[model samples]
Target: MPANLHAILSASSAERWLNCTAAPRYEEQFPETTSEYAEEGRLTHSICELKVLKKFTTAINQRTYTNRLNKLKKDTRYAEEMERTSDIYLEHLTEKAMGYDAPPLVNAEVKVDLTDYIPEGFGTCDCVMIGGDTLDITDYKHGKGVPVSAVNNPQMRLYALGALIKYEPFYGGMIKNVRTTIIQPRAMSEDDRITSETLSVAELKAWGESIKPIAQKAYSGFGEFKSGEHCRFCRGRAQCRARSETYTALEDFKDALLPTPENLAQVEQDGQDGIPTPAVLTNAEIGDLLTRGKSILAWYNDLENYALGAVLKGEDIPGWKAVAGRSNRTFTDQDAALASVIASGYDEALVYERKPKTLTALESLMGKKEFAEKIGAFIIKPPGKPTLAPASDKREPYNTATADFTGVTQEVLF
Candidate 1:
């Protein structure tokens, strides 16, 4: 669906504004930016809408569907993965509809209103299904990083609320249940890629009530300024004092390591550890710092990028300025350059280097199914390098003891 207008309190960004309260107003100064990934997602979503309309409804004739699909396929960003992923999403919708006794009323890319709760909030639901006492809302995510959960997800919940409001007149308060589903085919595992959670109408309404005050505060732009994981997508994150304070507060944990005058004097003689502070940290300190490690890195990079952009625009910062970095030379015409190199007494082999395509590239070249059918058996996957992660991460704990001896034998070593 083409969205030419957006509400100030859009349902899609509810989580950010709901948490930060001041993000919506603060973000107004920054223009929205798009990336190749976002463009690809929009293309994939268009494909999904077309798929649903063709499969479930009689609105589109075969000829129209074909022509529309053909036009979409011609987009430069279109890839086999888009088709494959959209099919996965369609299959999930089909399975859900089939589980019901009779065909459920389905709507694709339906525009929904949330003005009953939030101030002028409206959004487009990817798919909505109404049957008996239940309403199902499915959101398709094209991201590959974290697998979004349907449980307590504010975006999904808000969409569900908007959906209920959109169909309330027709259902006449008979709809008692709401189910929100997130279909992320690009997630790492099959089991976690698609997830669903059910909520009663009362529960959903209660949640809406809980956020009404916060929504009002956000709309008025007079609420508290707080920072957390939700700050990732906020345009003001780079300069927000609250977010900067959140990371700088970590310095308080280092009070124990503060250097004394005598300790600093010892460092004057030789660069060695001082006497006042212990060289090692306790497990508690490690645990405390580890919690903010990922956020610190992300915040640091965002700040750096912002500073670079500011400097390039001729803004002055004390002791800081942007300068040209190193650049590598490249041939304007690679084929001609290579041909010249070969003709100039250089062997053809010396002028060119050959490398095999990566597995991902090959998979994209030959659609996923064909790639698996042709050479899946020949592929081997090695264990990944160990890295630190939080306890709440979905991946299993790494076992250093087993990993050390799994492929080693004493006889071979001897």
Candidate 2:
């Protein structure tokens, strides 16, 4: 097999590259790195692939499957969670396959090419299914930090387009509709685990045409620099000049509001504390500030991290130096320390604090179905605290009246 080389305009990073066309070239300065989370996700994907091959196709025999699975389980990073989550993923695939009137064509770990639209663009689709007229492309997201939506998701749509191109010759262009799905089994809530969106073949092709120019610009390293939430995963996000300028735009707002001498003189004294206070910001100003303020904290943290990393590497940064951060003390040998405490006339139970497993932990320990069946009635989800979000946020607005009535008593009056 040929070595897997990432495309400059790969489908996975399409969102970032499409939005900030200059990101792909800028990110080349940073070295590639992987985290434990990424390693675990890779292992999980391997497991899912093996399960799909064994169940959906005749690619592997029983003995081979068992041997491969056991070897994977022996890896240090492997955990029972991987097995349980992969099982759920397999069940989902089984159900999807069964839903078709006839057994649909299923494939796992499919490599699709998109050179026609994007220059050398390619990606690995986790699962692909083709029934009579619909082609389904499903991606397994192992991370649990955020829920991914399939609606107008660029990555998934790109993958769908690539899959269509790859299967065109075999299917003779019989595919009419395309379905893109994201499965995040470890999501915080069960309802959010799966999300799917369907588009007709014409629509998917139209979207591909829409991005062809952007893709060419991105591939040629001749695109404009833009920044937004898409910068989160870019390798050079911390050092990107466009991002720095975007966040620092907040500095201009201060000049917009200048306290005139007359307004300063009109400053009112607090009746209770007798402290002079400047004129309060208008509601419109507050809204404007909030719009810019949303990204300031994240940008500040990224800048601080970049500076600290540079300083640690012997680079001199004016007014900034790396110092040892505070850390908590821990017993070098916890078991030995606990034993010593027990021998010093202290009860062994006092040295340890007992607590029940959290609902999430319990659900992981026992499978989700078993946990629900055993103690479903005991579980409850209280209303979440009110949080500020932009108008584009999907969640419904919180009701102040309902919030005030919660945990408070109301007396009936005649």
TM-score, every prediction: 0.78, 0.85
- lDDT string for model 2 (1-414, tens) is 124586787788888988988888888889877889999999999999999999999999999999999999998999988987888888888888999899999999999888878887788899999998899998888989777778879999989988998897789868999999888999875656888999999999999999999998987888889998888778888988899887777668675454544454555322233223356875555776787777777788888988998999999889998989999999899999899999999996798999998886788788778999999987655446888878776667878877666535332211
Q: Where is model 1 more than 4 Å wrong at Cα?
A: 1-4, 172-174, 188-192, 255-277, 323-385, 399-414
Please report, in order, the local distance difference test score of every candidate based on alpha carbons: 0.84, 0.84
On residues 1-414, what C-alpha lDDT tens digit does candidate 1 reach at each position?
224475667777888898888888888888888889999999999999999999889989899999999999999999978987898899889989998888999989988877778887778899999987899999999988767788788889999998998898889978999999999999875656888989999999999999999999998979678888788878788999889998888766575354656567767767776444547665655776677677889899989988998999989777888989999999899999889889999998887788898886687678768999999987755345788778886667877776666545433554
Worst 10 residues of 1 by lDDT: 405-414
Pairs with backbone N, CA or C atoms under 3 Å apart (clashes), candidate 2 = none
Error of 1 at 80 (Å): 3.2
Instruction: State, as a TM-score between 0 and 1, how close model 1 is to the true structure.
Output: 0.78
Off by over 4 Å in 2: 1-4, 188-192, 254-278, 343-345, 401-414
User: What's the residue-level lDDT of 26 in candidate 1?
Assistant: 82
Number of colliding residue pairs in each model: 0, 0
lDDT of 1 at 278: 43
